[model samples]
Target: MIIEIAAQGGFGGITAASLRKTIDVSDQPERMRQDLCDAFEPDQLARLASRPCTNCADRMTYRITVTEDRGTHSFTLREAQIPPEMLDLIDQM
Candidate 1:
């Protein structure tokens, strides 16, 4: 699996300084993958993707993309909207 996280947009219609990171999980052990999957919680991600925020001000917007053997999924969230589990996942990477 490969993951990419990016930050874009901000208050006053000013584009925030871009930030991004990419992570590759293909070489991880099965156990590690399972743990990551559990923490990532695809169901939660799906729900987040389904209800994207339409407006944001004075805040950085985040876009997280994950690609795996099955397929790819992406989610857009504000800095304040990032889940703790997702934050942990990012820290691990």
Candidate 2:
């Protein structure tokens, strides 16, 4: 599986090309791979993305896309909606 993340709209409301990250779970260690898969399960990610969010100016928004053998899923969510663990995963990628 492959995951792509693009971050936008922070304090500066700007997103450069460098803000994009791509993670190839297949290349990670066995444990890391398992953690990633568990953290980014399609059903869970979709649930988080679909939730309602209140006004949050200057907070970052992230567009996360996951591609698997079956197909792909994409979600755009406010930073506050993302779990802390997932946020760390994005950063480490």
Candidate 3:
């Protein structure tokens, strides 16, 4: 599977190259891969309950995309809405 993470709309509403990251699960270490697998299981990802924060100020919005045999899925979340596991993955990226 492939995962892409991008950050946009910060203080100046700009998205620099450094704010985008992508990774293929097959290239990661065993432990990292397992963590991704658990967080991306059909139910876990498909049912993520994050709600965009409309009142955010000077806060970046994150866009997450995952692609696999099933197709591609995307989610846009605010920092406060990101789940811990996904947050860790984002940090590593």
Candidate 4:
């Protein structure tokens, strides 16, 4: 069953049960979230560190830095209204 959550942070909070036993990369929201986080966290951390004097936590800008991977590249992200999809595995409260 595909799940979507409104309260949990990040790509929402996806529970294990919301996914099928067989893995499918194209249709899995949870897997997409994990993959996105895996690919983006390092860059996000780097962007956060460049602003030392800025303390406006409510809104901030990302610092773009270029570095060599296979070649030189630059990337950045902005604080936005990305929606999080949440999942619930158990009904116990």
Off by over 4 Å in 1: 27-35, 50-55
Best by TM-score: 2
The better-scoring model by TM-score among 2 and 3 is: 2
Instruction: TM-score each candidate.
Output: 0.65, 0.87, 0.74, 0.22
Across residues 1-93, which tens digit of lDDT does each residue of candidate 4 receive? Answer: 112122221332333222112222335477564553343344543544444543333432233233323333333323332212211121110
For lDDT, candidate 1 versus 3, the one ahead is: 3
Residue-level error in angstroms, candidate 3, position 2:
0.0
Per-residue C-alpha lDDT of model 2 across residues 1-93, encoded as one tens digit per residue = 999888777465565323788989999999889989988878889999888777756788888899999799999889888889988888878
Better of 1 and 2 by lDDT: 2
Q: Model 4: runs farther than 4 Å from truth? A: 1-37, 41-58, 81-93
Clashes of each: 1, 0, 0, 2
Per-residue alpha-carbon lDDT of model 1 for 1-93, expressed as tens digits? 677888776568877567788866666787767766665555666676667565546787778887877788787777556667766666676
- lDDT of each structure? 0.70, 0.84, 0.73, 0.31
CA lDDT of 40 in candidate 3?
61
- How much does candidate 2 score in TM-score? 0.87
Residue 79 deviation, candidate 3, in Å?
A: 0.9
Q: Which model is ahead, 1 or 4, in terms of lDDT?
A: 1
